[model samples]
Target: MAILITAKNLKKSYGKGKNTVHALGPIDFTVVEGSFTIILGKSGSGKSTLLNLLSGLDSPTDGTLVVAGESLNKLKSGKLAKYRAKIGLIFQFYNLLPNLSTLENVMISSWLKGISVSKQDATSLLKQFGLEHRINSNIKTLSGGEKQRVAICRSLINKPAILFCDEPTGALDTANGQIVKDILVKLNKEGMTIVMVTHNEEFIPMADKIITMKDGIIESMNTQISK
Candidate 1:
């Protein structure tokens, strides 16, 4: 498989001089195309920081990060924005617009990208996620699981090559979390590259590669036989 992401000697630090805090890296890894990769660590383990760098949401303090053929560390602001548009991000909280209906929430991505919003496509995607009946309902009225599903639809509407999820099921109940996990696994089977950061051990078995982090560095990386 092709390598979809590469990080070489990546590092992230906050503050300067005496009070400086090293948040991540001085680490390296590659994400295989169409593979499900999970970054597991306790809170403050720098997993989220690593995700931010990989997704082009933030730049590394030092070293190179290449994603989908673009060097994130070298891209200018405009170019970086363009690159980010091709990547999807799913947050822990259902970051939907409370006032917007499910369909509208999904349409927001197109609107932000200066592209035409396709209700048909949005509806189709939502329906695929079992949210067909909730399309017209306000986001505030939906359950946590439904809201997260809507967030997934929003993330996918632009057809991103890779999806970056940060604690995707953190706020859901056990059953709902399992539903979200199943959805992710199904997407991976259908060839979507997924890089998820979670503290949940249950998801480790589902990933093609499991990366464990401690303090601010990778402790171990385990590759499982893909199903």
Candidate 2:
């Protein structure tokens, strides 16, 4: 598989000198195309910081991050915004607008991108995730799992080249987390490159590659045979 992402001595920090907080790397890693890769760690391990940088939500303080041939640290705000639109993002929080219906939440980004997608196009994606019945449901009415699934649908709205998930199943129960995991696994089988950050170790057997972090640096990296 082709390398979809590469981070060379990538680092992120806050404050300076004595007050500085070393949140993340100086870590080097690569994400293979169409692979389900996990950044696993305990709390305060810098996994989320890495995800933010990789997803273009934040810039690295040092080193280099190249995703899909674009050097993220080199892109200005305008160019970064454009680049972000092509990348999918799913958060632990659903981040859906409460005033909007489920379908509206899914289509909002597409509309913002000026993409001409009909309702059926959006509906089909929701339906594929067993959300057809809740197509018009309000965001506030949904459960955690339902909201995450809707968030997943919204992430797919733009047909992103790579998907970045920040603790995607972090807030869900075991069953719901498994459901989300299965969905991601299925999507990976269909060739969507996914990078997720999590503290959960239960997903070890499900990963194509696992990047473990401790105290803002790589603790270990392991590649497993596809499950």
- Model 1: ten consecutive residues of lowest lDDT: 109-118
- Model 1 pairs whose backbones collide: none
Give the CA lDDT, 0 to 100, for residue 140 in model 1: 92
TM-score (C-alpha, index-matched) for candidate 2: 0.96
Please report how far candidate 2 places residue 196 from its true position, in Å: 0.8
lDDT of 1: 0.92
lDDT of all predictions: 0.92, 0.91
lDDT of 1 by residue, 1-227 (tens): 99999989999999999999999988999999999999998899999999998888888889989999999987777887888888999999978998899999999987887778679999999999999999999889999999999999999999889999999999999999999999999999899999999988788888999999888899998999854
Task: Give the Å shift of residue 15 in candidate 1.
Answer: 1.3
Every candidate's CA RMSD: 1.2, 1.2
Candidate that scores best on lDDT = 1
